[model samples]
Target chain A: MAVLPNAGADALLMTPTPLADWLVVAPAVLPLLVGAFLIIVRKRLHWQAPVAITTLALVSLASIALLARVWSEGTLVMTMGRWLPPFGISFTVDLLGALFAVANSLIALGCAISASRRVIRSSRRYGYFAFLVLTAAGVNGTFTTGDIFNMYVWFEVFLISSFGLLVVGSTRAQLDGTMKYGVLNLIGTTLFLIATGLLYGIVGTLNMADIMRKLPLIEAAPLMTLATLYLLAFGMKAAAFPVHAWLPASYHTPENATSAYFGGVLTKVGVYALFRVLVMMFPVQLLELQTVVAWVAGSTMMLGALGALAQNDLRRMVGFQVILGVGVMMAGLAIGSAPGLAGGIFYALHSMVAISAAYLLVGVIERRSGSASLNALGGLWKDVPLLGAIAFVLVLSLGGLPPGSGLWPKVMLVQAALEAGRGWLTAAVLVSSLLSVIALGRFFLLTFWRPSSTESRSKHDGTPRVLGVLTVVAIVMGLYPEPFVAAAVRASDGLLDPAAYINAVFGEQG
Target chain B: MKTLIFRTVAPYLTALMLLFSVFILLRGHNEPGGGFIGGLIAASAFAIYGIAFGVPATRRAMWFHPIAIAGTGLLIAALSGLTGLFSGTPLLTGVWTKSPIIGFDISNVIIFDIGVYLVVAGAVSSIALALESTEDNH
Candidate 1:
């Protein structure tokens, strides 16, 4: 391995070996390569599904390996183009990032499986699989990149591919949905770019680790303005309060598989960016803003849950729950303690699986009954007992019930808030949980328990098999949360102390 | 629906614009004119032809789906990054190979630029064509 001596030299600095760092790049690159390949053979409809599934499976395997490597090695950093840290693009993955990437890959795999048949039959003209893989690549890049500007680039990549996916079939409803989704998201990304420009102007660097090192030397006033700008930009992306109107209006109208993918993976990337930038980069600098964030967190939870309670459409109801999940994660960040950070990480992992599974199950029901409206849906329990049982578990987990994945994270958050002496946040979490129970429970009874007007058997599909696997994962994680809890604690430690991350990226000079 | 002026000038204009696009793409490594601008320029040429001669003629001229071109371009860009991996450098690290006989420098950067050029051209053209076809149907 050739080590370039000069810090900002243009010479290529080779690592000891390339294969050692392959996992860091593989998760992002594999999907991109696969997507390009799928596009080349677009006319061969028979090859699309198998190729997509295989590619996603490989990506998932790579993501898991990356997580394992990060778990053992602490933060892993790789600089692109062999340039030094502040001058070139770099990707650094901590345990939190690795965990999120793994979850993202799994959710994408689930969506791919769910879309296999539908894409082949109805979406042959739209290049559905290519956009799906491109979205995965974008999400992976967002999770793993260590540069702020690079994160913005990945956000655009995600947004563009998602725009394609949103209106692939070009139905009237889908086109309307795409218009709202596209315009609002474009506004959000533009804000994000503006915030990036401001941050660069202030710090003169966009490398995240470098910015963390330089931020403290700068004045606090301008930094607060940047923080507010970030909150607004990422808030729109996460669909947080005051700017969450686009999510429910558009998310419910996409195809079931696409909806499931967006529900599980898309907003979480925004939340991930928020957690990464706000909590990790400016923990001490943003103390005054944390209180405002706490209020926003509480309102987000309350409003999202309340909105869910008012919806009769199943996908729309779950769309609000996605907002609720974002609020829960925000509460963890607001508390700003190690325990709170851990709780947030845990809840993010839990919700990614549970939310997507819930959407997939609803998609199956919709496929069978030809409607996702709760008022028109009934007696599904008798029609498909297996799906009913899976839906019950998913709904329970979503509502934060005991013996479910959601409950553990809520408990952790409540305890953290109590320890941090944030009694209002504790109250917010409990109240939101109560509201969620009412909302999801009402959905449960309406969709499954009540007698139906017709008793015909619904058509079966592959959604259940994929969703069933996800349900088992959620159940297992709930029953034995020791490993996941430990990982969350470790990830929170990384977030709370940026020194390890800084040193890894900048070497001893940091 | 043909415009006499556009139809008379379209073929020569398209050929010149495409040549200019390649020149821009080649100079992109060291100059401001790169794949994105080059691709857009080429797509404009196609748009002119489409408007003058209609979509069917434009489609015939393309001879391949613009989306496929975009996808192929993406693959080329991604594969160019792998050259760095094979040379034991970080991803997307430019590996230069100077040719003795030609006294010229070659690098993966140029390959990546070409990839970017194709992707931009393909994406823009596909969107333009789709809109035009839909309008034709209506």
Candidate 2:
């Protein structure tokens, strides 16, 4: 087999040289690389027992180490094989990128732990789990990669794995859901490609730093507009309301672990890309189009939340809720201030963690009650204390309650709206948050408390230990988020400073 | 019988297709061929093999879903772009070297080209695989 070029000179030479930063990049990517190898060789392996769990564990530890390194040091720049930027591919990690990359890895590890049982029951299931883990690898890697072309490449990575993950069951419903999912995402990706190619054509450089160096010098509204087209493409991938038909249909297609991991982590990659492009490479351009983004964000928030309110299925309701959060985060970005960006970033991080936990518990709900319908289930707290308690905490955090990470983000958004001097926008965000609270709250009450017609006192309280492990992690992250918060700040700082990025690439490589 | 295509031609076709896939990947950076087209061609070969023989026969010769190959390939390609962050370019800026590789332009775009080859190959192959699996189940 051909050896991966990941073993490049720059990547291999991570030291005082600019390439040292490339070390940070490996944490996000190493998993998929290893997992994909294992998956490809699964049929030949004698012992598949450790294949999923061991890889997930290792990836999780690597992600943790990556976060540790980013937090301890300001930002890490690891060029592959000591190769300079603008020439060789580098894996760079700022605080935000590393934090999420690590968090996503850990979350994925948790899901894999849970899915261990589910997979063993089905011989072909490990192949599917491998795909899911690979998607996580893609998710983490996409967030960390600073290159425009590489980002697009990672998006495709996620798409391919997720496509497989979503269609794993291949049931009639899964088939229909996946077909729709495939067509829409393929279209979105095509547009994303067009955007990348166009951006490259205009700038003649595909590196993020190079684009930043060149972007401020170029004077063309059409080029800027085309770049925004890519942002919109990414937004559609994030499942913003107008273009989000595939999410509600496809998310519920897989079993619970997937809805937990894939649903939770997938769209965040798109949102992360949007934020990276807007705040990092083209802030000036993004700010110029702020008004349009503002209105869109407000509308999206309202629409997604309302959609969530109408959903009757447990998974679909949470799926819509995640979309609603996307709307809120966009609104924060539209506000466009230090607090606004932080809030938006915080909300994004919160949603990724919260949705997965909610979905994981939904799986337990499905396992126990034999149904996930609002009409078919309830009295979870009376039956399963731990799941109920954990779900309560995670759902509340998602709902943006007091003293939680979600609340701080909303506070920042409020501050941002005021900063933009858009009094109406501020009110809209507040109103939207209120609407979300109501929608998610109703889902909670309906799913957790409202006694279904077939409400049973007996609870299958034996949630796999894996679910417990992830639930604990989510709650801990919710309680003490300083490390991640700091990481987000660093990522945002780097995002705002295109000059440093440009210098890294052009000065070293060019 | 359809098995005749399987018995004689399929084996030769399978090896030929796999070999061609590699050839396309190597030349992609210099030309229009890369991972996407290469992967697609290989997938088609597999599909042909699948039809002539059964999916099991085709799969027995191959391992992994084409999409998974693409996913990992996508990861590799994306990591290449981020390498710019260390050097201080916006993500995905290509660096060209006028250094004569015995007198020619050697660029990192080749890496990008390889990524495209894998992504296209993986995507097309997976889509085909998915459709085939769906039809077989039905």
Candidate number achieving the greatest TM-score relative to the actual structure: 1
Interface Cα RMSD per model, in Å? 4.0, 9.3
Per-prediction fnat values?
0.68, 0.08
Alpha-carbon lDDT of model 2: 0.71
Quantify all predictions' global Cα lDDT against the true fold.
0.87, 0.71
Query: What DockQ do the predictions score, one after another?
Result: 0.57, 0.14
Model 2: per-residue Cα lDDT over A102-146, one tens digit each: 768777877777766665435344466667667877787787776
- Per-model C-alpha RMSD: 2.2, 6.2
Please, what are the lDDT tens digits per residue for candidate 2 over residues B1-138? 276546698778878987998888777767877767787777787777776766666566667666566656666676666656545433454556565445755555667666666766666766665667666666
Q: What's the true lDDT of residue A96 in model 1?
A: 83
As a TM-score, model 2 comes out at: 0.81
TM-score of chain B of 2: 0.74
The runs of at least 3 residues in candidate 2 whose Cα sits more than 4 Å from the true structure, single-residue gaps closed, are A1-22, A44-49, A80-83, A448-452, A455-461, A464-485, A506-510, B1-138
After superposing candidate 1, which stretches have Cα over 4 Å from the reference? Answer: A1-15, B1-3, B134-138
Clashing pairs in 1: none
TM-score of chain A of each: 0.96, 0.90
Tell me the interface RMSD of model 2, in angstroms: 9.3
